[model samples]
Target: MASRRIPKAAGCSPIRAVLAGPAENVITEKLILKPAPETKTEVVQKNTSVHNDNWFELMAINHLSEKLQAATGVKSMKSGYESLVEATAMVSKIYNPKRQQELVIQCLDSAIPKIILNMIKTLLPQTQFTREYFAAFTTVFFTWLIGPSEVRESEFNGRREKNVVHVKKCRFLEQSNCVGMCINLCKMPSQAFIKDTLGMPVNMVPNFEDMSCEMIFGQEPPASNDDPALKQPCYKSCRAIQKHTAKCSS
Candidate 1:
């Protein structure tokens, strides 16, 4: 018998396929806006790009700054972090290498506390719907929830970290027919608006009509069709027939 060739085992985690397509191609509850596969979403909508870029820059600075902070704890003199060599050399005070390593290790281990991570995950649900706005939201939500972290404030006392980066409105150019965009945005399910924008017969959805608001959710509907706001065009359409009219009235 011929010898059989054995195939190599795959890595434990499967790699995701890269998306390669135009920027306009997006799938959302709203319209399908396409986006280029390779482009970061930050680039597609340039107005939103500025705020998003700050996040990426901040994350990058974090890597470099970690060494600077850790270096302070290092009682010893050397650094093996090659990527940071230039940045480190600028402010690195020579210390005993062994003591520094111990401090660095201890500082790293205790850097991210569990309480903050739990708070972050709780407030920021990792979902497609809110991903675009999550980082900015995380900043806003944290300040609202627990106020500032004592350590961060105490360390950088005078200089304030600006969490609220200004995000500008995307006023797309007049080049394309924005009619489609306008109509789509005006549709219901904005998630922000609780009441139906359509004012569609609530009955359109299954069983929504059969049960009155009061019956279903223990909340009363408008008392009378005469109420100006609740009075819909449907009332006028059927108003020809009086509810109290006799059959002989015909």
Candidate 2:
């Protein structure tokens, strides 16, 4: 009787056949891999919320907070927006209105090195480009204090330009909830800071009704007496008003 011949698979090796043993046995002895158990560390990471969106945002907040504390000589127990508000309130208490504005400009001066300021002033010409550049820069670098913002078109020197930063809702104003704080601690100081340190003038017009603010770059800020923001009344819910002993010059 002729011996029956066994056919090899298209790419099967004799070694594989030896390792797998008989085809029937190989089919029955299937190997299943169970995923490794999740570690406690992985579980914790999965449940954790990401507080800082990016490294730049976190660094900016920390540096500004440190500068604010240094300017006011008051350490904040909290961080970020709360810390800024605490330092601002302390600054208001520590200095006169004029001095409060001065300290904030000084804080910004220290926060940004004079050399960097010089470079910005010397390199960026005072033109529409510079205004638009700083407007875009503000939206990117100052989102922590101002919240989400966008650059919009506005008339600068009778020409339409995209040099306005419309802050949807100012975090500083909303959190402080004080018109005086908004003007002394933020609007005036910020305009001065930008003008002196960045060599670009800006006018921050805040709408007390909705807490929104529009920063018009290249426009000089109006005088305190002429400013509508200064004339606005303090909120009844203001923390300063809540203190009863404190008077808010909103």
Candidate 3:
């Protein structure tokens, strides 16, 4: 004897809805499913690679390279890494510790709201005057431009805050390999840009041990005398320190 197979009900997906009753008694269940919206974290995680070929990044590098070259009388023979090193060396040569801070802040002020930042401003209309928004923005932007970073949320003054960005490894710092450059170029200028230009107070703390850094937004920086970054000795691998070992030693 041949066995008869049961027919599935109309408009019912066998995989989505299992039938336990006769075809006539089976409830026609329609499963309407959609892909979930991507969160900011998900979006950032997806874009892990640095967008080196992007026009915004290219323009920013050029603009900053030109400005640094002009300020320090150092020219960039090569793009990217070489330009960064040459510019940093020039900055070291042209200014004392005090003046280095000033020049870096000035250069950043003039250079920031750069193409990428401007695009961010235009894209994220709601990224104003909020620590959380800026933090999220930084996570995506920095991860795109620099490298991967972790965004952490915490409470401040009895309110939930998302203002801390932890850089597992700073590509620029690692490449430049100079404590002075980290302070004068990356740390100071970045803080100044976020605080002055973006109107959000921030303090950048670099950990020389692991080459990690923390960008704390919505926090005021301490005075020079009290700031740890100001007192950090030059990196052992610092080209400036090697070039002027006698002066640095004294």
Estimate, for each residue in 149-187, the C-alpha lDDT of model 1 and write its tens digit.
111111112533322212122211111112121111211
lDDT of 3 by residue, 103-197 (tens): 66666656664776666545644332467777777777655334568888666677767778888767676665577777776777677766655
Ranking by lDDT: 2, 3, 1
TM-score of each: 0.18, 0.75, 0.66
Candidates in order have lDDT scores of 0.27, 0.78, 0.66
Lowest lDDT block of 10, candidate 3:
241-250
- Which structure among the candidates has the greatest lDDT? 2
Angstrom error of the Cα, residue 120, model 2: value is: 0.6
Cα deviation in Å at residue 18, candidate 1?
Answer: 85
Please give, for residues 1-250, the per-residue lDDT of candidate 2 as tens digits. 2333357668974332223345565445578999999754344233422234367776787788789788778898987656778778877766677888888888888888888889999999789999999889989877876888999999867889999999877777776767788888888888888887778898999987667899999999888789888888876667645642345674
lDDT of 1 at 87: 25
Displacement of the residue 101 alpha carbon in candidate 3, Å: 2.2
